[model samples]
Target: MSEPSGDASGNDLRRSSALVGAGILLSRVAGLVRESATAAFLGTGIGAEALRAALRIPNLMQNLLGEGVLSASFIPAYSKLLAEGRREDAGRLAGAIAGLLLLVTSVLVVVGVVFAGPITRVITPGWPEGSARFELTVTLVRILTPGVGLLVLSAWCLGVLNSHRRFFLSYVAPVAWNAAIIVLLVSVGLSTSEQFTVAQAFAWGAVLGSALQFGVQLPGVLRLTRGLRLSTSLAVPGVRAVVSRFGQVVAGRGGVQLAAYVDVVVASLLAGGALAALGYAQVLYLLPISLFGMAIAAAELPTLSTLDHEDRRRVVERIDTGLGRVAFFVVPSTVAFVLVGDLVVATVYQRGNFSEDASVQVGAILAVYGLGLLASTSSRLLQSSLYGVGDTRTPAIYAVLRVVVSLLVGIAVMFPLDAVQATSQGISVVGDVAWQVAPEALRAADAPNALRLGGAGLAFGAAVGAWFEWLLLRTRVRIVFGPTRLGGPHARRIVLAALAAAVAALAARALVETIDLHATIEGLLALGLVGSVYVLVARAVGVPEARELTGRLERLVDRRAK
Candidate 1:
């Protein structure tokens, strides 16, 4: 096998990380804007709920089968072949995978379109009785389902580019996605409601967004590869291996999708914008994890794959060393959401059709989700490690474990705490949420009540599931590195750093509250001051790692300034 020269290997990792990071960053911003716009146009209404629910089908499928899993399984194999000097064969593998994806996704999209109503019935049966919400959802799914194909193609392109250590263009595709959606939202707003329903416009935007995701990367892909020819031959050598790996990737990824499906089922029982609340909450929770945790995961993958057996030890060590930094970045962000969740919801979404009540409700969900952010972020990195090692099944196993625990926890917790009823005790503004996502709607509508009966079941499920995931990670780490060598001063330093960050975050929260800066300009100013104070405290509290990060950041700024 031909090994990548030192310079070439280093350059490859850097370029891919930068590109994927850039694309993810852009996509995250655009996604926030899309969520904001959707909230504005539809609010927490039946329309919003239906739209969010419908959108999930395509998105869930995409996430489950497209990005992480597809890339995880495909990239390693592709990279291995290339490293062995099998360029033409690698290219052929890419084309074969792409052709297979095209065929499979094409079939799925058609099925989705034809059976949209039945799918909706299965997924969100209680979508507001006697309302056209159900019908509209069906319509929207049909319009958006084709996106599955485009996105699958985009994923293939991204994986191919990542294999080549080219990442920038792929990352920017999301910028295009958001821009397209923003345009659609603006256009719809400018026109009369009679002209086009927001649901229809958003669906069209989805199709356009997926196209943009594919289109933005075309030039890059074309430059990297000669051309793609659809291979009809099933006897393609690498095709079976890639497809089988993809299946493992899909199973591993399926847990997250299943978790999402559970949310939908729960929200369906809850009725009246429950889906929107959960959707909004999930996105808000995902932001920091995406920003920070993903930065490390994205950077680590290609490097991990190329590491020699001995150097692979460093791969695990790098992950451990980076976890502190990841926590330092992510913990505070999660806290910020927890502390100012209501203000955030109010600020970004509480206008137009989204009322103060809706903001409060979503805020509550966001707060609970905050507790699990660290677990979620760490899980992603852990899975990335598994991918790097070409062991898709381990992560798949962990995912299944997580889902089972989540479901069990959800069931166990819902029966005892009935936390929904409990949330109403003090927060009148969000009291409706307890009522909204309740089992009553299901019983009243004669729908299955498993979701509501399973209430707090989902939340507890997440908590328990996250624990199992964390355990899975520890076991893996132990196997990689002996148990005797694990958990000492290094772990202590990280905990202390997290403690410092937590304390700083709490102080920031208090200052923001004291200045009454939560609702207006004063709040923004206070938030800035609090963030500054946290940095200072983090530095003083022996958070040298965090301090180093800030130092590196300032050096970059200084260089830019010069």
Candidate 2:
């Protein structure tokens, strides 16, 4: 029998993409339910705002050091070292990175706990003075800070696993964290009589969940590589080099993340609930982006690390196919969300303590975020390409540009227009200007129309900045990979398959609506049925790329069976 193609490998780009995508789908679904549960329990309240602000600081650090920034640079260097037969070097570097990360994160947790009050004040200056919100925000931050250590360690483990071509375990690890959080939530009742407030309960769950995130990956990492050994030698050849490059990458990522924090700061300066609204919006928007886009990024990395010019061309072709397919699924998704977000939000969360008015506000924010879905996904792909070529500084520069542009755009767009007043006196009318330009947050608090406009502006600014980064990266890709040579007939087939997918989705939606489906059960059924239809239709369309993806999946199952 002919040996299986590299596609047959368990951690092959396509197969791992499918696996990670599926697992992430599960995680995102649970995450949605988790957010919905939280929203229902604590809608637009002091508790919810406190939870959001508390979560933001540690989560921001995680973005910088754990997944987005750190992984991009760390994984490529680690993988390259392994690919070049420097296994010991790779293991030592991994150990060193892990040791350093653990020490730094431990210190951060202590500092965050000791200085929670001042941190919360800086993060959310408009938090009502001496209120429950302020106190709770500080408390939750202290509770959640330790997660930084667990999460950072988890990222290092995941990076090592991915470098060694063991993906399933790492991909499945997030499930444990999700399960832990769910168990905690279920164990604690929603009634006010519960021992801990919902915020406190969730805070505890986060700690347990992050522990699971790190713990689950340990066995696999141990099995797949040499044992970890820490050394005081900061001068380990590749380790120092990787860390220096990673430092630059982290600084760039930190700048962009600081911009994100700026958004939280601005929103917190608004009315009481703006912080929560923005948080909910971000969580919901990231679902599809992270699920598919990050899967493609993860899958592409190992292959990109090993490929020659022709092979690299082929890999980018596969990436294009994958990205185009995502666009088809996600574009209509964006449209549907823009059209029916209010209904979806209301249906999911309107009952219990989450009122209809709150649903309307959250849904409006979601719709604004929906506009940037494609831009975000495209940026993920382009950034992966840049990292694949071992050019970290280019992306760092692009990242800084995005931060600068977004800040300027956010300011310009958020400033309200012409706050003038007029009064009539007997025969003459007199006008007195009260304010030249109303700040958006005040206008959003007092005027809902202006709030929606401000949201639109923020969303538009974000999308513009993302696309601008993509454009710059596109030029880099052209320069690096020659002009117009990535896509092939396989790409064409994937496009046809995606077109069929759109049709299948519409058909599925129609059938569900005809039956008057409602409730979570109905929603789940509709998604399942629509997904099945898309697969079947893509199969019928003779899309070889789709077939290739499915074929590898079958082989992976067969390998496990043996």
Candidate 3:
């Protein structure tokens, strides 16, 4: 009967999660730099929209076949084998999944390349069939297809590495991917000013970078999985279990990815910069989820998979503890994004072609996304727990439900928002239903990647869908597990501390309101002040995760001093 907040595995979970977070932090920082460079060179122009759509289009293959699906389908059964000291079986499981993924992804890559045009049409129907923007998006999609396949294999490598408790390289390996893009973007920026040419060059760079990312992980996977023998046989004993889970996880991941795809499609229909603005906001929005939420869930999964499902007490304690850890970090993140997100966006992106106006648009989208940060992060852990307990189908069902809700809401809001034109005179209506009757009227507003607020509707819809999924998950876990509900046991204190922190942040901002300060410096002062206030208040409120973090910092300092 271990308490929800104080489990024996807490230390190991924290250490492992820290490792995962550290790796993700490095990769995400590099990703931000890559994004910043893209914004600087392309701005929120037609080139930027095409590039963002192109990058995401072939990523359909990766999302269907990548880390989220693999983490659920492959990791649990594989981890169980290793925990039982069955390295040979573990290797066999790894090899089969890798071989299967290779076969599936290779075929998809070829199909993606061959049918890139049709796929592009479906993905970005907003672009006319033979327009310059449309054709360019088609071409970039073809270029990035094979590269995305390579990323799928890289995810397989991650499954092997994480199963072996080598969290850093698998999570950090994307640094190579990001770095390669940055290097090419810089080189091309120096040589040329052509937007289409820049887009093409970066697409090729992405392909090369994908190869590097996969290459870096293969050696480690090989070393750890010595008994591995590659095959496509479905007859392997545990292979059936993996495949069954894989199907359900694919459905789950597919639904989630589809929500994103639909958002892109709708954004394409909005004014020009909506796609790029959405892209910018998402890059920031996903940071905390990847760093804290994904990290903690990843660390817990292998351990959770090895636990006895019949012993519900142990499982509940693990999940509740992890959720609390996630909430303590994410609550304040939500506040930051909502209350002072413009500062965050300006600090990262308000340079070169990424104008102050663009930053404001992106920040507005981010604030809506922030309102759902807690739901999204909490759902990540709940989904992991469901996967660990072999209840993959439940999450899949909810994921689809979430998407349905999101699409209904998103489409309803998007068209109306699109009809509302932004003018020099400060916003005017382009007829209440002009998007339905006047295609020309909507196109007049688009302006090839110009700023628009329509994307925020998609963000708002997504936030609503996220809460629905989280609530369903929270209840389902309670029913499935014996006596406990899935949630952040420490959410109350964490949220209160965050509210207090937000108040202090507001005061700091007011104090600096009239001062002439650069976006970066102003952001640092506000974020730092808010963060410090959160930590101190959380400590006073006796939030365990905060106390643990502070205690760890103090311990490290003492050790360094000695």
Candidate 4:
């Protein structure tokens, strides 16, 4: 139970992050495919919007009682007990938490199902009452609410597995979740004439998927924590501690969720497809955050929890390393989104009912989100570090502040943009440009205008809030652990590398525009070239991380040659 030495801890951190990242990558790829199938079947219309709203409405339960809160509270306390060699106490605490989460979520799920109509109405007041879309949303919410309860249990399993450093199985178990959706989409093809029918199919599939996700992780949790029993007692030694921390973390997560709900409410009032468009953009935006930010943060939290708070140097070192690794990957991802997001969107989703116009809409929102990629990812790591050190209140305070900033910024930007028509009249391009290939159905004069800028406004507001959160977290980390090694020269190098990659990508895009290549092919080529150029430039600028990455690639190549 002795704490890992500094070098051993760093190596373990990297290995754990790589494992989690690999698992997440597979799950995210499956998720992207699931989304593509959804778009192909439902399109970015009322059906899609209703489905998205239904999913988000019940997701409140999972967000409040699920991974974020559990990771913040349960993992820290459980890991601490293990570190102290209190195996029985840790197992009991896990069981107690599991029982408590099941009980609370069960009630919430039943109430949610019973009152699905009212909940859907409150969440999406813009939809006309008794309309097909509104009715569909209610039905879908009822189906999806039970899935939320299942996912809360899955998250508890995740908390236990993570505490024991069994990161891969818990993190990758979501493949079952995504795979189930894909199977449903493929089986129920787009031939279903009614959008509501399609939505219903997806809802049922999601419920099944949540069950599979939890089932896959249960054995691992049991193996890691033997003698685990289902106990509803909150009086257990470490259970009380976790519950105490859980409340603040839930408040923090609730603040974050409220900001999202605000976006949903505002977007609901804007246009028919506004919510759906926002959902599509968020899927693309979260890809890098999950792959890089969450991977690193999730790996480091358990290890960081074992660190003594008095060891300022070790705390600063671990946090700084996490931050740098996050920036190393996320910065390029941001540049990619800003420069070639349209091409990426077109490649991924512009087919069937998902029109070229939908790609443009999603891409524009994604570009705005790109502006805050670094900030958002950094804030995640910073929050994890705070949780590791048992300082949840600071983040909770800032989370509320972020919500206020997002709401204010969203209103200021969306209303004006909604009034202006978003047309692609002046921009002329050869080949498969987003505007040119848009379906006439999407461009019909009778189509809703609120769809044009409402999504963009939400993205902008989120970006603003994300940067504010990062700033607050950064300042707090500095005050608590001293200035990190990430800022001075290291930051400049990252910026320069990102700039070089952006230029390379832009140049590749320009070349593609002059020629007659498929947008997907052009996007892939551009991304590849940009990524290569970034690694080279980063290495030239003396970035140790970049150099280390290059070294790994070289060793792999040498092995292949051998």
Candidate 5:
């Protein structure tokens, strides 16, 4: 047997996961910069919501057909072909899938552009028809739809690359997309104060960036698929299997996308800043998931699929360590977000049009999102295990359930909180958010002065849904595979370490806030303290990942000293 290729070793799993993590880290940092520039230019104003809402509608095309579907369907099937040493079959499969994806995405692009107005209305249910923001969102959607077509093809590239274990190029390709937006936003922001004009420019930049993202990965996909045959033939070897699995996974991903659409719709119904603020908070919330959860899960899927039926015991061992590794890092992230999220959010976005209060409100939403951080991260790996075993419909069923629960809970809680609007006192003009006020704002003397914390309720609803998904996923995995509980020794140590770190960090945050330290400096100091404390406590409690991290740092330091 080779290590994951044959020996079935967990070390191979860890190394592959590290590669995925590094790629995601680079891409996420770029995305963060793009979001920061966006915050500075748009703030939580109407322009921000318009851009965010516009992206939401067209992005549905990508969301349903994107990486998740490929991961669930294509990777497992395509990877199995390679594992059997059928390179020609694998190449043909990849080409056929790519051709089909291109055709489907082309159709989506046309549908989205032609029906942009109706789609915009459906996506932002709370926005009145024919409003200026609605019209702006419609225009932006037309511009962004082609980009979605490009991004879908990018996802095809991702599937092929990930199956080949060429993880970095596919994962890092998104940097191009983020970089393009950041460049355009900064350039336009420097030259103008008109939000609508900036929004229009951003749409074009995003489309170009999406093209660049796909273009960057094309060479890699082409290189690996040397015998590639681009065709939409359903009869290609393994193509039917891929298509069958793709349908099931799309069903699962579709349910998840439905929940997200509900989130946008519900937020549109809230007071002015709900959608925009939640968008900012989500950038932070999704970072850890992308870095740790997704990286580890994605790395494991191909290997897990290869090992399916041949070595159940070895596969379960891999799952245990992957879950614990994800838990070790994610626990602290959850702690930091819940305890010091305001500090982080302020440091990242409290400049230009983004006010201090808006950052704090976004922080609160991050904290709410933090409540289910562990469960959400854990669910990814669990789902991959299910996918590895060829059970897609179960996840699809539960995904629908999760969305239903999320919408019901979110709707019940969001409207009341929306009554109290949130806005910055520094802004003399009400800006463009006037059209977004909740009904109760009409009776309030100081409606704009209210804390726009309604987004937290929505976040809380999402957190609950996350945990529900995790619990269901865990139960299914246990029944199908073996014991997949995350209550391993390392997870317990991670929890304790996170708690101790949070306590000290809270003290650090309070002391730093007492002084007049700059927001960025204060955040760095506080977050640095949290990271240091968490690692040290985890080391003392004998978490092996902590020891591994310490050893790696020591090795790097020793080498640099030379």
Candidate 6:
């Protein structure tokens, strides 16, 4: 358990990050396929809205106690015990935490199933009682609660494997989860004409998927801790430490989940398809954040947890490198979302029953969400670093502040925007190519105002809160590490590269549009052109990370050629 040499540590970090990123990439692609299928079947209607709400409600359990909380509290404690060579104690602590998680999740699952109606009311007040949407949501929530319990256990497995530095299996395991849903969607196609029945099938598929997700990771966890056994005893040496930290981490994660739930509630009150539109946009927004931010942070946490208290310099170095790498990828991704989000949304979700109107709505929401991509991703690494140093309380406090800010801003913006109906004249004033594609159904005089701009307001509020959180986190890191080197020259170079790449991408998109090509084909060409230009521009700017990435790609290409 001794620390690797400094040179070795850097390489290990990069290699581990690459592995995790590969797994996330596959899992995310599968996830996108699952979402695409959902959109094709449900088409952002009332059925889609109900299913989205139901999924979010039970997900509260996993979000509150799942990977984020465990990474912050349980992983660090257990990892430290392992570093100290207390294998027996580590095993016991792991078992105890697992048992406790199951017990609590089981109780919550039962309560969630029984009180599905009341729970739905609290989370989504816009849906009327006795309505099909409300009833379907309640039913789906009941069926999905057990799956939440299973996912909680899967998260426990993730904590174990991560602490042991077995990163690939745990990260790759979600493919099973996504695959289950994909298979179910494919099998039931055309067999069920009703959206309600299709949604029911999806709900059950999700439950089966959760079980497979957990089952796939169990063998790895067992292999890592051969002697571990389930126990409810909290009397182990480090068990109390984990328990105490768990509450703060849970509160911190809960604050984040609360902000999301607030958005859901606000979106629900807006229009029938508002929540569904937000859900679709969110999947696209989260892609880069997961691929870059979570992959790097998750890889670094266990290593950081093992650092000596006197080695503040090492911790500072890791933070800088991780943040820079994250920004390198995410900045361009943000640019893509802002510039070509309509194309991206249209390509992904505009087929079948998902109309051009739905695409426009989701595209706008994505553009707004793009504004917060850097802040949101940066906050993830900052929080992970703080958790590494055993200071969970500060992040928890700032998280609560972020929730308050998001809620206030959401209300202030959403209501006023919703009041202004988009008349024919008003629609002309909002001149954009993306808007030209909107269907007649969305542009009609009787269309709901909420469908026009409410989702964008929600997105804008979330962005404001995300930047606030990032500011607070960055300030704290400076105080601890003495004026972080993350923002001066390096940031300027990244922004310049991203701007150049975005311009090239825009040109590529224009060329593609001029020709008679499908939306999907146009989007792919633009993305490829932009991505290639980004790497070339970044390399030309003397960015070391960019050069390193290029070198890796070259080596990969050579291997393939061989």
- The residue ranges of model 6 lying beyond 4 angstroms of the native Cα positions read 1-5, 419-450, 487-489
Candidate 1 accuracy as lDDT: 0.66
Question: Model 6, range 1-562, lDDT digits (tens) per residue?
Answer: 4667777877887888888888889989989988888888888777788898999999999999998899899999999888888888888899999999999999999999999999899887766677787889999999999998999999999999999988888888889988988788767856876878888888888899999999999988888884587888878777788888999988888898988888877776664466788899999999998898899889988887777746777777777878888888898888878887777887788777677677767877798899999988888888888888898999999999998897788767765454333321332223222312234344222333334556777888889999999999989977776455543237878878898988977898689768988767877777777788888888998877789999989999999999
Q: Any runs in candidate 3 off by more than 4 Å, and if so which?
A: 1-7, 419-448, 482-487, 555-562
Best by lDDT: 3
Candidate 4, 1-562: lDDT as tens digits: 5567877876887899988898899999999898988888877877788888898999999999998889999999999888888888889889999999989998999999999998888887666688777888899999999998999999999999989888888889889998888887678774675777888888888899999999999988887785588888978888888888989888888998988777777777665567888899899899999998899989999987888878888788888878888888888888888988877787778777887677777777888889888888888888888888888889998998988897889777775555433333322222232212123343332344234656787788889999898888889988887776443237889889998999998998798779988756877887887889998999999987799889999999999999
Instruction: Find the 10 residues in a row with the least total lDDT in model 4.
Output: 429-438
Estimate the TM-score for candidate 6: 0.93
In candidate 6 the C-alpha lDDT for residue 65 amounts to: 90
Among residues 3 or more apart in sequence or in different chains, the pairs in candidate 3 whose N, CA or C atoms overlap within 3 Å are: 272-449, 272-450, 273-449, 273-450
Clashing pairs in 6: none
Q: Which structure is stronger by lDDT: 4 or 5?
A: 5
TM values, all candidates: 0.86, 0.82, 0.94, 0.94, 0.94, 0.93
Q: In model 5, which range of ten residues has the least summed lDDT? A: 442-451
Candidate 2 lDDT score at position 12: 56
The CA lDDT of each predicted structure is: 0.66, 0.66, 0.84, 0.82, 0.83, 0.81
553: Cα error in model 5, Å: 1.0
What would the per-residue lDDT of candidate 5 be over residues 58-160, giving only the tens digit for each residue?
A: 8899988898888999999988888888898999999999889988988889999999998888888777787777889999999999998999999999999
lDDT of 6: 0.81
Instruction: Please say which candidate is ahead in TM-score: 2 or 6.
Output: 6
Query: For residues 446-519, could you state the per-residue lDDT of candidate 3 as single tens digits?
Result: 36544567887888888999999999998888887743333367767886798899997797678667897987
lDDT of 4 at 176: 93
> What lDDT score is found at residue 39 in candidate 4?
84
